[model samples]
Target: MTIEQRYQLAKAQYESWGIDVDAALAKLKQVPISIHCWQGDDVGGFEVNKQALSGGIDVTGNYPGKATTPEELRQDIEQALKLIPGQHRINLHAIYAETNGEIVERDQLKPHHFQNWIDWAKKHQLGIDFNPTLFSHPKADDGLTLSHPDQSIRDFWIRHCQASRRIAEHIGKELGSPVLTNIWIPDGYKDTPSDRLGPRKRLKESLDTIFSEEIDSTYNLDAVESKLFGIGSEAYVVGSHEFYLGYAVQNNKLCLLDTGHYHPTEMVSNKISALLLFSDKVALHVSRPVRWDSDHVVSFDDELKEIGLEIVRNDALNNVLIGLDFFDASINRVAAWTIGTRNMIKALLYALLMPNDQLKVYQEQGDYTKRLAVLEEFKSYPFGAVWDYYCERMDVPAGLDWLDHVNKYEDDVLVKRANKS
Candidate 1:
């Protein structure tokens, strides 16, 4: 159908469901979207094994370590791409420190290997989602903080960022697809909150400097600003989360939100609102909450599922990157891929349907009766109607795989916790 025709049909459908068709249609028009790799292992870090992912590739690796051979790295990328269909468009660093402390010299790969990789990406119709980060190795000295207090660690990360940017710029200019660059640091509060906040501070400052001076404008449109929160319970640096995001925004960067970084009390929806309000900048690291653990998968029905989906739909953030965020020790690669893709489709539908259009009117008017009316409207939505509508529209694969995964563990633990009297 033509774009205009599609819009009209969408509006008619929305109204049929007792929704503000105009508003819903308008909201739908304003969203753009991308997907990231939060489901697969960090390059070659740890394989996530679970019952759901029974017959898939093991999401495991040791980044630069296993990637000692350039061919090995290329093979890994090829395999990962097959699992996540559209993820080829955007790539996240599954294993930043995958090589452990072992660094691969540029010569290790052929003189033209970098360009070859770019060409391969183009061949596969993929755009690079560069997540240059520090944290895969248990022994990774603080590229963001104290481990590099005196340039003690080689400028390994810095060099990679520069190299990746150059490659992205080359491809974006030549191939017309912007390569995205992101920075997320996991170095924080090792012992007694050291006075060495200067290192991380300098690290970010250096990153900003590199982006400012080196990154080509071709790469600007896809730039992402990411932050890591909390460090082993109660350890944090001076300017980690807010500081980095603020800098990125100042330089026009989209904020990348990780799922498991909250301090237990912070609401994801509220955080999203604040970010959206502050800057038209937001990319998501999608994952289901397992108590405090950030199980990187699409959520199965828990208390927070509906609330979170409501926020996504109400906000109409369709264009942002959706990372699976599935980082369990054992996860079935195929199951993770299938479940993530299916969940995202469902999430998109849920977002399209669940706007609290009248809630805003109620709040503005301060009319309790109007608020009640809107609440009743919300409650009136057809039970599982969104899913049914969704399945009708798209080809849905069989079996409620995520439910099975959740039921095995989510029921006993989650139900008992909710049942505490």
Candidate 2:
């Protein structure tokens, strides 16, 4: 059958179940996923004193053609964004600032340090998100930042986070959108610590200091991320999930949930509703974990679909901020971004096409048998037809046709970098 014929059939099938396929597509188009910039550079940012990645996080493999400069990374991102199906924003780490050959310390950074990025984003008509780089520095070599024992070290990180908030506000004001400033510190111990409370107390105090200056909500929103464990901090993580949940609620901040930052058995989809009940907003770092925090490329797997369903079913699309977070240096960096982002949009489209209201009615009416049967039947729906139609509407190559664009770009752009080096 032709693509239009298949979409017509899918539309009829969905309408029979009281679903508005067009409305779903409209909603999906409005939700913007924030694409992480680290994927293009393998987390190697352009800084005067670029330190090796440390603090319990590291990227594996040595993929050739990894972006080594700000211009190259932006070029790669532009290529990837072309293949993605929906509008999106770019998430930037503080380490990615362009200093123009000047030595700028993290704590002393200002909005001007990232003026080029702001201008580039403006040209592309994209919103910008910000993160404080708390790792991969001399001070954080000991697996701690805001929670460090030394007062001077803790103060330094506090200042860096404060500066990051200011930068985020500046970007938001320039772009006319609220920039999400997420703070994730790698502070913990490899082994059981003698004084657990001390680190957490210090962390809380440091957070208070960083957030003391109130910026307009229209300009910037604050989020605190927590991790269950890391490569080195297996035994203890200072900012546990509980700690950040409480902190977010107490401070009226958004809590960030990184899919790989939780236990192996824990799925972040289950925590969305609970967190949203108390917090006004919840930010997500969508990633795939292979038995551990590996930061694999996101796939359109069961968990991803569930995460999308949770957001759509709860009607929390605006309240839940979705973003991609993964770094796999083994594959083509541009392909990694393209594949992960397309899959993320695919998952959301899948959720949008679901018969959520019917399922909810079944559950509320104590019709478990019907609910199970309807849900099982939904698996066979013509979701691919709808996805293809959406991609076509968005003016992006549908199906695997996008792969040709990535391959062509790799041949013309990425491979040349390797040959030159």
Candidate 3:
């Protein structure tokens, strides 16, 4: 059947439930997923003094066609964005700064180092988000950054983060939008620590110093992310969920939650409503974790659908700043981006098509039986029809059609690059 005919049928089903499918599709289009740039290159940023991936995080897989340069990474993102059905933002790290082969220290990285990026962002009409690369540097080689015991190391990272915020401000101003400059550090011990309080106290002080230089929020927004434990931070992490939640609450910064950073049973979806009560905004790093924080490609699993439902059901669409964080080079890099991003959007669409208002009414009225039954039944609804229609309308491929384009791009572009390196 034609995409339009399938969509019309699906639209009628949703309409019968008093759900406005058209409005949902329209709103979904407006929601921009901040696609991380590191995915294209396996987090190997174009730094002259590049270090091995560290900070309790790692990206495995030796995909042959990893984009080795800034231009290539940007071009790769363009290809992924082509298949995705929405206006999106590009999230970049400080390590991605291009210094023309000059050795620019992290603390000294200026906005000009990213002038090419700014110009490219303008050309594509994409918004830019920023992150201070806290890991893989010599200073962070001991797995301690802002929380480092040494006064000089802490001071250096503090300066770098401060510089990062300023760079984000410049980018935000150039792009005419506020940049979400998120700070995630890998400061913890591989074993149990006797002096846990010391590191956290130092971290708080460093953050205070970094944020001391105030930029207008209209240009840049700051967020802090927490981790359960990482490769080096197995025993304890300085920036635990409690620490950042408390810090962000008191300091008025957005608390950035990564899906894989929490214990398996814990749900970021549950935290959304609670955070919305106190904070004006919340940031997310949507990633899939295998056993630990493995950073696998996101699948359209139950949890993902629940996350979408939470954001949509709470009416916190604008309040939640959504971004993708996983990097899997095991498969085709471009295809990995396409799959993860499309699933994220699909989860939102799934929630949008649900009769959320009625479900809430059922819950409020203590009609749990009917609510459970209806929820299960709606899962079998014609969600794909609406989704396929979205892709077609957005001028991207619908269903498996996008695979052809990715495969062709792999053969035409990626293969040649592989042969070169």
144: Cα error in model 3, Å: 0.5
User: Per-prediction TM-score, please?
Assistant: 0.67, 0.99, 0.99
The digit string of per-residue lDDT tens for model 2 on 231-278 reads 889999999999999999999999999999999999899999999999
Clashing pairs in 2: none
Best by lDDT: 3
Best to worst by lDDT, what's the order? 3, 2, 1
Reference-based lDDT, each prediction: 0.48, 0.92, 0.94
What clash pairs does model 3 have? none
TM-score of candidate 1 relative to the true fold = 0.67
lDDT (tens digit, per residue) of candidate 3 on 1-421: 8999999999998899899998999999899899999999998899999999888778888888899999899989999999999998999999999999999999999999999999999999999999999998899899999999899999999989999999999999999989999999999999999999998999999999999998999999999999999997899999999999999999999999999999988999899999999899999999898899988989999999999999999888899999999999889999999999999999999999999999999999999999999999999999999999999999999999999999999999999999999
Of the pair 1 and 3, which is ahead by lDDT?
Answer: 3
